[model samples]
Target: MTGEAEQQLRAYVEYFRDLGVREFYRRGEPVFAVETVAPAVAVASALFAAPEPVAERPIVARKPDFLEPPIANPVSFDQLAPLPKSRVPASEKAAALLAVQQEIGDCTRCPLAYAGRRKIVFGDGNPNARLMFVGEGPGADEDTQGLPFVGKAGQLLNNMIAAMGLKREEVYIANIVKCRPPNNRVPEPAEAGVCTQFLLQQMDIVQPEVVVALGATAALYLLGVKRSLSSLRGHWHTCRGAKLAVTYHPAFLLRDPRQKGEAWKDLQMVMAEMGLKAPAKG
Candidate 1:
């Protein structure tokens, strides 16, 4: 057989292997058998050993009788229930938050722990800083490095802080959850709930003068309400005595450059509260 034909046969065998058709031995004799439709065998043989390669055959996937499109239910804002609350009080919540870190040390609470390398990203920057930045969660780089906002998004955040005439070390930065979500996807509601106390305790410790919700998740967690960032941005909401503001996360800004103008506006609002002037656009 030609090199191309041999390669084709190898691919065919691999595909059969994937479908659980393995070689077997019976009475000290080896045999390869595949239980497939007669038509499929012809197609496989043609692709694998034809003297002249033929055009690719169309593939049709079999659908199960029970396979139907999901039904869409009309959901009303009022019908949505509030998230379940943690019964722990402020003090106990703080202690439990610390304990979770100590107990889980390099946690695997979620499936994200298995992908690539990661370390438990607790948080960093002034534990007592009067200003805080809360992101949704870590990304690939942050997960591998075991730190929050250390990638390009992080640099943009640092620049945002510096625009307010403050350094990253001067303000506290954290996420809603300690560990990253797999494939950098958003955390499920239950996962967020599991990690909520840690963020709450971080707030309790820092007691920031202003809390900046870097995205919708952070804003929703702090305000206990579901609203678009547009409606929440450039305004101050009170959270446990600290003024809360919502803005597009640096990561979001990176994806949607158009929103950076509005983010800058939100940052100016925060700076105004701190008695600082917004940096002029060069």
Candidate 2:
């Protein structure tokens, strides 16, 4: 077979593996039983089949691979790296962020403006924060409060912060898109693109020593590439001059409490780099 045909066959084999055709063996099945095997048409269909739809998200070209494993510790902050030793002067950060917000005044830059958004959530927390958290977008509660991560998920985030030996106010927070997508859907790429400069500006102002992207959307936009959370998580990347870390959004943890441990593991890496220890249980 030509190289192209071999590549095609390899892709088919991988798809079948995803569909649990692992053993390809049964007590009565023939070792070379072409008749018993899934037909070529079936394999082709599997190759073209659409991925499962996520609620509240539109069908884009291909489903966003929110679950990717791109690299294996490409550049682990394996040990504490010098942090917060240099950053935007604390006195100047608040005014810088405020300037970005003023520029975003009553934004009609996208359809979200007419989507019944309550207030534009610029960001919240200490302007001079050494650490910052970025998430997908404002949800219902954040929409109402004009703040990021203020709902039940925010509560969980609060716990995560306390566990990190810090409070919510001690760290800066923002989102990929400032306005809430209707019904809490992921921000479409176009919408996020329009708002990218605002977010980038926010990061520049705070100039955080370290940043944690709170979900796949935040990770995708910050890194300026289509990457799976798996690829970005537990690793560090440089973003607008700050050490970037990726972790699960607190909302995800609320949905799958079991993954909280995994999320903590991701944060502990940040803790180590920042020279933090979990508060002693009182």
Candidate 3:
């Protein structure tokens, strides 16, 4: 086969594999084992030959080598856990968040733990802030520094925060998964499932008044609904007792700069709700 054919074959195989067909076995016994169908006589003979008396045996279907794993549905942050009887006090929110981080120490609760992560990148910024930003997961720079959004995307995010007339330090930043997914692929649903348990706890403690989901994945898990970012954008959603807004991830805006204006519009909606105004241009 040529290279293109091989690629096409691989694509088909993966497509079938995704659909739960691992190996293709013969579907069923052939109509004729040794005889070729010869015209009308063969057809009539075969139709009449079904009268042969034979002992009946039970038909057993061969099972596949492995079953396709179940797809994990995204559960909204609120549905993940019940609200605490009482909210974490602002005076102790920082220490309470620290305790949550310590509990996640050297965390191996999810597969991302062993996916060559250098640090846990628990979260960053003010624990008691009324605004929070949630991204999908860490990148190379974040994994190295044990912080979220510290790379080029982070720079754009800082600019975005500045646009909102707020300092990055004034808001809490975190992700659905704490560790860098290998090669920065979207976190598997199972991985996000394991980590968001911790994330929900962080939200509960921080009790931010507003949350900005910085992409589809963040919006999906935060809102527990698989929706187009366009559908989720330009509207208010609720998460962890805070209003939520969805926008393109900074990384995506980096790839497609034209969308920055739309993202800014999303931010402006957030600013209006939070009583924030853009900084005066210098």
Candidate 4:
């Protein structure tokens, strides 16, 4: 190996050794791809997303209590009416949504804009969708692509949408913060504060029948109250004239696969409110 490559390999070995990993798994000359990689899979958006726990701060994924029954309120979507003053024309939704994007042009509204973010992940999917999914913020992939939920977490969301018998293009998706927080950490209150109005405006345009808050950040911000994911979950809440439901973030599900069943249950509540049934098995 070259001197630089050798040095990097030694540093990697030392770092793992610090983690108490004693043995090396090398059996032969390792193949390293020196070529540039253009990742397309939604899950591959995590450029800085750590696969292993850090020595100082380790993450502990959990298995939720699946036995907890999902809240099943058979609410109808058509019955939902936008608050009187918030009157928005459904026919002009696409134009209105685009107008909001133009208003957010090259946003530097918060420190998040200056924090190494390449692009603003405004929102994606249908502008007139009956269902909208709001996540915490962008990831490495999202920052690179300038779209929400374009990484691995996004792929899981695509499956979730399919399970609801809906196409990816039929639903709107967005985040609590338009920019990716450093290291994918939860967005600060200040960031969410300045950016939330944009989301609210988008909701007004879309007029979705259901809104799914993915994880704590989305749920807390949407509900305007602090509560545990467990407490916020398994029930219907109202936000911006739509029935809101809370669920685990897909990135959290990637880390803790066991909780997917629970997230699905949260989604089912959304589906039920929309009078949706899952697609056929075959």
* Candidate that scores best on TM-score: 3
Q: What is the Cα-based lDDT of residue 237 in candidate 4?
A: 88
Question: What TM-score number comes out for model 1?
Answer: 0.63
- Per-model TM-score on C-alpha atoms: 0.63, 0.69, 0.75, 0.70
Question: What are the lDDT scores of the predictions, listed in order?
Answer: 0.67, 0.76, 0.82, 0.75
Decide which is better by lDDT, 2 or 3. Answer: 3
Runs with alpha carbons beyond 4 Å of true place in candidate 1 = 1-100, 114-117, 278-282
Best candidate, lDDT: 3
Model 1: lowest-lDDT 10 consecutive positions: 70-79
lDDT of predicted model 4: 0.75
Superposed Cα deviation of residue 103, candidate 2 (Å): 1.2
Stretches of model 2 off by over 4 angstroms after superposition: 1-88
lDDT of 3 by residue, 1-282 (tens): 966455445543443333332121123333334332235665445445444334543222333222335345767888878888898889999999999999888875555664567999999999889899999999999999999999999999999999999999999999999989777888777778778878999999999999999999999999989879999999999998899999999999999999999999999999999999998999
Off by over 4 Å in 3: 1-68
Q: Stretches of candidate 4 above 4 Å error? A: 1-86
- Give all candidate RMSDs, comma-separated: 14.2, 17.7, 12.7, 17.9
